[model samples]
Target: MTSQSSLATEDTPPGGPENPGGGSGLQAGLKNRHLSMIAIGGVIGAGLFVGSGSGIAAAGPAILISYALVGAMVVLVMRMLGEMAAARPTSGSFSAYADQALGRWAGFSIGWLYWFFWVVVLAVEATAGAKILNGWIPGVPQWGWALIVMIVLTAVNLAAVGSYGEFEFWFAGIKVVAIGAFVIVGLLAVFGVLPGSDNPGNGFGHLTDSGGFFPEGPGAILTGVLMVVFSFMGSEIVTLAAGESEDPQKAVTRATNSVIWRIGIFYLGSIFVVLTLLPWNDASILKDGSYVAALNSIGIPHAGQVMDVIVLTAVLSCLNSGLYTASRMAFSLGQRGDAPKAFAKTTSRGVPRTAILGSVVFGFLAVWFNYQWPDTVFDFLLNSSGAVALFVWLVICFTQLKMRGIILREQPEKLVVKMWLFPYLTWATIAMISFVLVYMLTDDAGREQVLLSLLVAVLVVGVSFVRERVQRVR
Candidate 1:
């Protein structure tokens, strides 16, 4: 393993005098409120609002178990990432740690793959947001709305990191409030107390009245896991954003510690309310979605429209963070000599302009592909990057395992966020991630995603090895 001192020799601190843009680097533009909201909002995605229906449909009320399982895994992974990130406080985050603990190739491959994943997400979220805008104003075509949303958010990101954080703060705040309100109302309706509830006294029978908790069978929980795992992708975005905060270490520590409640309340608490408010196998769930169906059960006026607004906020927030994350990853790669030097350059405001434009350029192309070739090229893009969340978590696990000893031997004071149970829980988290990847192969849709993602990963790793060999020869 590369010692801490050796890793320091290889890379300058972000914003250090060695930076190419006359020594300017990423600014500490994000404030405490921005970081706090980001941590809360990162855990709640449009997927929770929109995608949980299918998981509920698949696993019945037992989808709770699937969610709890995945939630535990995410908490563990974030803890490990927080441990490394708190110690080092780099925008590169896990990718930087991987360079020191694993190898340069490990860092290079994962960093680019992560960047690719978010750029592709930019296309997905932009299109989703467009569909909503076009629904409200039919005059503009769906593609036009897509273009408009992309341009607006791209401007937000390019303006300053503070602008991005401020926008996300409100977007995320809306989502947090929405979910909180839904849970409170749903609970009231369940216990026969809500004043306007249509489904008063629904009770917990919804958990087992229809066909028991595991209506599909116990194994469906695993299937539900496959469905919900991707939703957790953005939970670690705060760690990356922390590098630009005034106190990266404190930001990382707070985000990590709070992850448990974030996942518990946003995911488990909301899903429980939905399942309790209505049956898991309710046709309305499959029809209008879980949250909408739950709201309608409580006699909320225009529940579907309310959810549409919330989902739109979520899509825009995701798009904003996706661009920010992809650019930072590219910038980190540039700093480590794994990407073009221009990517490492920051503007007078300490923004990586080249990196931001490069990520958004691919994002724009991806949006075009979604419109032009929805089935062929765009479908491939989606499937090819589907498993990257697992890949990233897995890398964090291994990196933390190695980094723990190195940090202790070198700078033990930085160990503010330690992984529970040391190597044992770290190893267990690794096993769980591996098991999920292996389990994905059993389902047809998941099999295709895993295989395609593996193929892309192999190609990236091969390129990294070749690049390393050429550097050595020179």
Candidate 2:
């Protein structure tokens, strides 16, 4: 374990982490079980269910390659982060690593970008979740449901880390079980094992016949990459949550070691089944999202309702994780003195109460946008964040590359969860992420949204940079 004294900088004192409600006897708030589940389910967001349809449409069955390609990048990036996180777990896992490896400016800029990313995400989740609920219960306006969702999740976040863990554990568990079950059933149908199955399983034929591997052409796959990368966004939640673990280092190692496989199987496996069982360009799936089509094709009764419920659960889970992520990132910033110190405050339950509540305000406003201006602000919010995902990922890669040597010099044994090929994979991942960013900027379908997102990301980065410069001069 890293010496507690070493953990403290000017921002964080030696005795405890930067807490909002002063130090509370909340026992670090979460245990191994909660950490494990949040680590698992936290990454499986609505993207798997909804956003995948667009990706498949763009690249056809060959979209699997897109997912695999991005997944490889994720594996390498997480491995890099895992090395640092396992050495010294802290609330600001990646940011802290960036600070140690790069400089105060790098951490300050990236950390704020990450925090901004999730605050926007908080709104997106609420709006997405509220849409499903609003349809079911018309009397409750969509905006009203959004408010309810944010307030409720905010309450969960404020309750305590243990409670947050418990909530996320179950939320993530439901998704794992549902998607896992979907994969098993889909596989049976693929092998012609499902009872009374009349429809012919197309298997690998769907992957090629629809558009062939390069159906939309090599150029289209790049467009597909723009959408596909967003689905992989939540996988790093494990690293962030690991900071609160009782044994932070071990938890970081275990979570990072396990996440690559989990994300690969769940995401790639499910998408494979979807494309194999039904063509990528299938009308029903394209019009209504892939999950709906997969469920309905398998002869699941009330596929729409079933998927609506599943997606609703996903939205809530994402919202829950969004609030948690944003709060922690803010808390990290505050503790590091990168932001106002008030954000570092923790409640009696060791929860970052102010940050949690403050983050949800965006969620509420997002809900309002979804209800009153769905076509304008809400859609822009939805599309804008897709590019920012790439930005956050790129920063992680650079931070890791710079920090690896410092970490090894300080604590060599922490390399147990290290990325294979060391700097090679790290640099490769950086190149891959950079390619995705450039591709997003070029893709016709994603051009406006990506451009706008890039602008927002730059503004945030620039502000953070200037703030640091001023501080240094002072």
Candidate 3:
């Protein structure tokens, strides 16, 4: 796979994706820190902040267990990805791993589905960001703001990958700092340190007071799991970033090694603070959002406005990452011949301009869809892309299992970040993903979203098969 291929050219490196450069875009100047924060920050989207409020409302404080369950699953998946990425670094990322370990078809299927998911996410975040912008500048229409935001991020990506990374770093940094402050203030309020946060059963009582853990029973926790998994979706960006970082191997190590702490700080820490501050069923928890409620309880002036700023930053960060990721996935597919060869070209600065443009065009269309058919088309987009996180994670597991054997047999030297307990942990994580999918099927609220996403997955698989059959006859 490394040294032999019909498509191989003189300029191609030993283990690199095809590099038909001086045609498309510039090189990514993102350093380790920029890349690292982008990786970490991507995981801390609005889902962790505002969306979790709904998840909490569903499961009460028991949602902590829900987050932990999803977090553990994510950690395992990242470790598997880290092992493969550490061994081989390419901008193609996990799709490359799938191609090498599974087959070209697996890579093509996952790449396109992941790309579709991001494009929809881009539109979703754009709408979300525009709402925030419109609130601040009422003179502008929401639709107009959405258009401007999309164009701005698209230009930033075309400018350079580092620009995207730098922007993401600051956006993510502000979110992290804001959440950290929320935790501190919430803790003070929970303990009745604040002047006005004195509720009937304050402090730790909130965790168990509302129906004594699992208020809505275990089923609600399962429902919360469906919502919580999306929060963990962004962590995989680290493996993607590793491909562009100065030290791909080190990037993987840092990404995987830090997974535990990320879960601890970002997921578990913030969540612990939330449950402590307010019961999951409180009306304010649903209406004002957990972070806002926490801030308000702490007597922070203009807490709602402060939280609005954080949420808006999160939306922009998600928007930037969505465009960057979709383009890279398409570029990887093109380089592998799963997509049009034109997408394989790179700019003088080493960027994939064609792929970037294609992704942005698709995103721009989705943005239009939000306005033109805000009622139905936007709903379909959301449903169709919602379940892709499971698909990507499952592919990662299968790819890891395949790659693990190949590495141990052919290149035992490349096992720095091995999955603990070898095949055991791998099997367990696969089971967890399967369970999530099955539970999703039974979940009335989340069922349609998963099924629609599966339909999109099936179409991608069918198309890849047809494409291969056509090539054979040609």
Weakest lDDT window of 10 consecutive positions for candidate 1: 9-18
lDDT by residue for model 2 over 44-68, one digit each (tens)?
Answer: 8888898899888878877888888
TM for every model, in the order presented, reads: 0.97, 0.92, 0.94
What digit string (tens of lDDT, one per residue) describes model 1 on residues 384-466?
Answer: 99999999999999999998998899889989999999889999999999999999999999999999999999999999899
Candidate 3, residues 121-225: lDDT per residue as tens digits? Answer: 898889988988999998999989999999998999888778888898899899888877766767777777755654432879888877988888888888889
Residue pairs whose backbone atoms clash in candidate 3 = 24-346, 24-347, 25-347, 25-351, 26-349, 26-350, 26-351, 27-349
Which one wins by TM-score: 2 or 3? 3
State the displacement of the C-alpha of residue 291, model 2, in Å, after optimal TM-score superposition. 1.9
* Stretches of model 1 off by over 4 angstroms after superposition: 1-6, 9-17, 21-23
| Model 2 alpha-carbon miss at residue 106, Å | 1.4
lDDT of 1 at 145: 95
Ranking by lDDT: 1, 3, 2
lDDT of all predictions, in order shown? 0.89, 0.76, 0.80
The candidate maximizing lDDT is 1
- Model 3: how far is 85 from its true place, Å? 0.7
